[model samples]
Target chain A: MIPTLQVFLIVSAALFSAGLLAALSRRHAIFILIGIEMMLAAANLNFIAFWRFNPQSQPPTGVMIAIFSIAIAAAEAAVGLALVIAEF
Target chain B: MSSAAFVLIAILTLAAALAAATLQKLMHATLSFAVALVGVAAFFFLLGAEFVGLVLVFVYIGAVAVLIVFTILLTRRDVGKDRGANWSGALLAVAVFGGLGWAVFKTQSVAIAAPHIRALTVKRIGEALMTSYVWPLQCVGLLLTAALIGALVLVMEEKR
Candidate 1:
């Protein structure tokens, strides 16, 4: 229970860094897409973690942003992969 | 240290994300991403956002993950052997990430002003979506619709 936010933040940073590396280093387009997903997940983690930690003062803006971001991410991935498929 | 469950989830999330990014096999990487997303969903639950967590499962695990794997299957030839990574990129990533980690660490002491969140139920979420967040919600729906149409168009090409 305690330090849950800390753990989540650390994990989110790790995910973001790994995703950035993968996106930069991968040759295949699909792997890059995977990297993008990891980054988005990291962002999502940050949103939820912050929302959890500051439950008494902040509105659920982080949660809403996270959900909206997830929606956008799903759509972006669908379109991006479809284009990649067509291009390849 | 807190309960074992929290530590377990943290480990699972990190391990899954690491595997997802580092695995050489494309299929394995995609699967690992799924695992990582699931772990994140669990984290959301622990954060008291049950609706968001389940939505993550549905959208990520069910839709997005499946879409990526299917795309991989469609373009099977492009997934060549892993080319490994460049040392420069790796070093740059480390330096950039180390700086970011330090920044967050330094800011950890600042107190954040947060409001109390009420229970987020389907009805409450729907009400908020339709009332205050209505425009954004509609925009998202429009975007998703367009993307779906575009996907169909992209995949429905004449056979060569």
Candidate 2:
């Protein structure tokens, strides 16, 4: 059986914390981008978890959001890496 | 959807994430970051979001990770060198995690298992984007184009 929503939330929280640690502790710009991407993935995990656990959901809202969110994150990664290269 | 599988994925994800955050070698840390993303995709699949899982693996691992590795190689720094973790930053991360964990435990959720519904197909998602979410779709495309051009401009060598 699927684990409770709380378990997913806790895992997502841990992922967020790790991402924060990476972003804050690292001096390199690329590390910061990696951290931000990790954090976004954690949030996406939460969206899917919530969508799956909710018994009353009708539309595939979370899936759609995750798709768009992935696109935005990809764009961000491109721009961010370019900035890192330009700055150095 | 077995709890055992979830536990395994959780362990893999957390371990990879910690390694990514704490590893000394920049290259190693970036690789660990890629591994962590894979774990996240696995979680998405476990939760029955197969399409999202595939996209996560495709975009994140295929495009983003390769870009990061190339950036590291192109920078020509002593990537082996390590400043290591900033203690203050680590402390802040710990504090935030503690608070979030407390909040998560406090909240109540009635559903313990995934609900039965029609399988989420890519066609349905396509229809939704074309109909109800067409505006946001167009806007995202516009934003992506802007970001692409802006990035190219930023990295362009200045004229003498």
The best candidate by TM-score is: 2
- Clashing residue pairs found in predicted model 2: none
Error of 1 at A79 (Å): 0.9
Please provide, for model 2 over A1-88, each residue's C-alpha lDDT reduced to its tens digit, 9 standing for 90 to 100: 5588888999999999999999999888888898899999999999988888877656778877888999999999999988877776
**DockQ for all candidate structures vs. native:** 0.57, 0.74
Candidate 1, residue B60: CA error in Å?
1.1
Which 10-residue window in model 1 chain B sums to the lowest lDDT?
B108-117
Q: Which 10 consecutive positions of candidate 1 chain A have the poorest summed lDDT?
A: A51-60
Q: Which is the leading candidate under lDDT? A: 2
Going through the candidates in the order shown, the clash numbers are 6, 0
- As a TM-score, model 1 comes out at 0.89
Question: Interface-residue RMSD per candidate?
Answer: 2.9, 1.6
Clashing pairs in 1: A56-B115, A56-B116, A57-B114, A57-B115, A58-B114, A58-B115
